[model samples]
Target: MYALVDCNHFFVSCERLFRPDLRNHPVCVLSNNDGCVVSLSHEAKILGIKRGVPLFQIADIVKKNNIAIFSSNYLLYSGISERVMKIITDTAKNVDVYSIDEAFIDLRNYEKKELVPLMRLLAEKIKKWVGIPVSIGVAPTKTLAKVAAHYAKKYKGYKQVCCIDDEQKRVKALSTFDIADVWGIGRQFSKKLTSFGVNTAYDFTQKKEFWVQKHFTIMGVRAWKELQGIPTINTTEINRKQSICTSRSFGATVTDIESLKESIAHFTAMSAQKLRKQNSIANIISVFILTDRFSKQEEHYYHTRSMALPVGTNDTAELILYAHQLLTELYKRGKAYKKSGVILSGIVPNSSVQQNMFDNLKNREKRSLLNKVVDNINSKSGLNSVKYAAQISTDKKWTTKTSFKSPDYLTNINELFEVH
Candidate 1:
């Protein structure tokens, strides 16, 4: 059996972990630069604050309702996530950290009754020790465990741990859950499934494997089997990431070319770091810029340009130079830009890349050494200890607005609080 453990209102919950006073209070975590509502607590959701609602639009509502808002503090979240995963790993024989706030653990050895009490103890321990509340769902497969975890979070009687070990209970849970709420069934598939009268998890599971495979591909077939309590998804780690793109909305809309260039350079540097961390190199670099889609002016503009590298690389300087070239080509004088991003595609492990003989490439050894040195220095210090020229003196205006961000109590000594 697999057990999926998911933290409740992860980002908001991370904040509440330190400030227990925020428990049961309406709270939300905003996207970088405090752009919008990215994570909301149940109480905040109850007050009709929908995810992705712009910060400005909800300011009055949040103030009137006394909603606690926070800027995204990834440092705190990452440390807490590590602690949570450590707790899970120490408790379970086999565990996969699926996300920042979720993990799938193999629980085939435990009986239903034994698992329930153990899970309750586990949840309480994590809450008391790690300061994060998690809901665990136990079933024969990862997909079912995910559904079980969702039900556990939604229902109070489950005691934050729901086990679907019995055939009858599994079927009952599947029958009650909407098909769209299933882990793998997205909106378009849900609509198509609904058209075929497969509106619930039970209905989807009832469909023949042949029909599901024909319409939905291998993943759908696997999900269907999983819904029927047949384990198809493996708990083993999948190392390959399909794509990696880094983008951010500005703290405020930017119109100046210099500021836009700096933002693109900064994002490119970040993307390069990620690529290097994964030990991957991209063959193509894609740059995109756009004005606010909701602007009243009929001038809704977006441009994307993809450039093939002479040779694949994870070097920050080379990537930023190429990105700047693309930015210069795409940025028109009169255009008002709100957001920009860079996508590195055709990514392959650095070890797998075949170097070109004829192309006049930059010194690979020097670039790699410089990148490593820079990364080490930055990691020892903070971001921007070393940065590209384009990023220098660029107004901090391009940063995300995080005026209400909570402290990084775990990482930032200066931000730590002490109370008598």
Candidate 2:
């Protein structure tokens, strides 16, 4: 059996962990620059404040309903995620961290009768220890465990844990679960399957395997088999990401090329950090810029350009120089760019990279060591504690708007909770 343990309304829940008064009120966590609603409390959802709705569009509802709002405080979220993952690692023998708020646990060795109680205990322990509510769904496969997790979160009576350890329970759950929401089923497949009268996960599983293969190919067939309690998906850590891209919508429309360069440098530095984390080097670096799609006043511009490196690198300095070169070519005067990003691709393991005997890769060993030193310092201190000179210097010029962000209570010593 595999159990999918996921935090309930994670961002909002994280906010509520500090402000208990907001526990019963309508609340939401906005994306960068407070652009749109990315997460909300159940009360806000009940009030029909849809996810991804612009904060501006819901101002009336927020004002009338006394809704609490927050900016995306990634520092806080990341700290809390680390704590949650630690608790899970200590609880389960084998675990795959699925996302910031979810993990897949291998519960195969446990006796069938103990699955429910053990999972329930794990949920309670997380709530008590981490002060974050989680729902657990145990099943024979990762896909069904995902479905069970949905039920655990949706229904109150499940006591925050649900398990489909038997065939009957599997049928009952799959029958009511929407096909579109099933694991591995994307929006396109969901629409096509619905058109074929496959409205539920059980419906999809009922189709002939060859028929599913004909329409949606082998991947869809695997999803069908997974829904039927057969484990086709392997839960393993991804060794390397195909591409590393770091981009964010600006807090405000930026008109200056210098400020846009700062954003590019910062995002490139971030991509480099990720590349190092994955123990990989990138052979290609791409830079792109965008103007607000909805703005009628500004002419639209969206373009991306890429260049292959003579030698792949994960060094922040090397990546930033290329990023600046790309931005210089791509930036246009009088264009109020709303977003910019850096993408690094053609990645290979840093250890496997072959040194060019011909090309004088200036102090390659020194650059790699310097990156390690900076990463360690930043990790021990705060995010980007040691950063490239090209990145933004002043906190005031920070690209993303976090006007309503909560304190970094967990990560910062000064912000730690105090009692009177």
Candidate 3:
């Protein structure tokens, strides 16, 4: 059996963790640059404030309904995520962290009768210790566990934990589960299934294997098998990405060369950090810039440039240097660019990278040590506390808007919650 533990209204819950007074109030968390609604409390959803609706569109409702709005604070979310994952790892020995807000725990060793009580206890423990509500769903497969999790969160009768340990339970759950919301079934498949009158998960599984093979392919078959209580998906650590890209739409468009270069430097540095985190190095760096997509054909501008490195490296300075060069080539004068990014590709494990015979080994080691120091300092002091000067802008016109951002309560010592 596999148990999937998912946080309930994660971002809103995180915001409420500090301000207990907001627990019963309407709240909505915005995406980067406070662009749109990404997470909402039940009260917010009850007000018909849909996800991804721009902040401007909901101004009237927010003012009238008194909805608490906030900008996304990734640092706080990630810190709390690490703490939550730690508690899970300590309790469930075999666990796969599915995402920041979810994890799958292997439960095959436990007796069937112990599943619900143990999961319920775990949920209560998390609430008691971390002050965050979680829903746990246990079943024969990850996909079924996901379905069980939805029920666990939806109905208060389950006490935040649901189990589909028997064939009867599995069938009932699949019969009611929306085919579109089933794990691995996207919109395209959902529309296709709907056209064929396959509205529920049980209906999808009833289709012939050859029909599934011809229409939905291997992935769809995998989901079909998973929904039927057959385990096909690996609940192991996810594979590392072959490439890392970091890009952001600016709060306002920038046209100057210096501001654009600063943005590119920031993105390249971030991509390099991710490469180091995964213990990988990149052999190629690519940079791209874009003007407003809605602009006139003659006004819009977009271009990309990539360069292959002589040797793979995760050094931030080296990557930024290359990215600046690429950006310089891609940038065009008089174009109001709204977004830009850096992509690090041709990745290989840092330990396995071939050393360039012409490269200075000592200097490479020095750069690596320097990066490690910076990373350690930033990790301790909060992100970008010790960043390169090139990442800082005087006017700060291209920076993300965080007007409603909350404090970094978990990550920063000074911002820790106060008690009287």
Index of the highest-lDDT prediction: 3
Candidate 2 C-alpha lDDT tens digits along 27-68? 999998898999999999999999999999999999999899
Off by over 4 Å in 1: 32-35, 54-61, 107-121, 234-239, 294-298, 359-394
Give the poorly placed runs of model 3, Cα more than 4 Å off.
235-239, 295-298, 348-352, 360-373
Q: What's the best-to-worst order under lDDT?
A: 3, 2, 1
The C-alpha RMSD of each candidate to the native structure, in angstroms, is 3.1, 2.2, 2.3
Ten residues in sequence with the least summed lDDT for candidate 2: 391-400
TM-score of each: 0.87, 0.93, 0.92
For candidate 3, the TM-score is 0.92
- Largest TM-score belongs to which candidate? 2
The CA lDDT of each predicted structure is 0.85, 0.89, 0.89
**Tens digits of per-residue lDDT for model 1, 3-64:** 88899999998988878898989999988877789999999998999999988998888989
- lDDT of each residue in 1-420, candidate 3, tens digit only: 999999999999999999999999999999988999999999998999999999999999999988999999988887777778888899987888878899999999999999999999889888998988999999999999999999999999999999998889988988998999999889999999999999999999899888888988678998988987889987442446788889998889898989998999999888998889778999999998999988775567888889999789999988888898888888788888889999999988898788778874458888899999999987777788899988997787777889999998866778888987
Inter-residue clash pairs, candidate 2: none
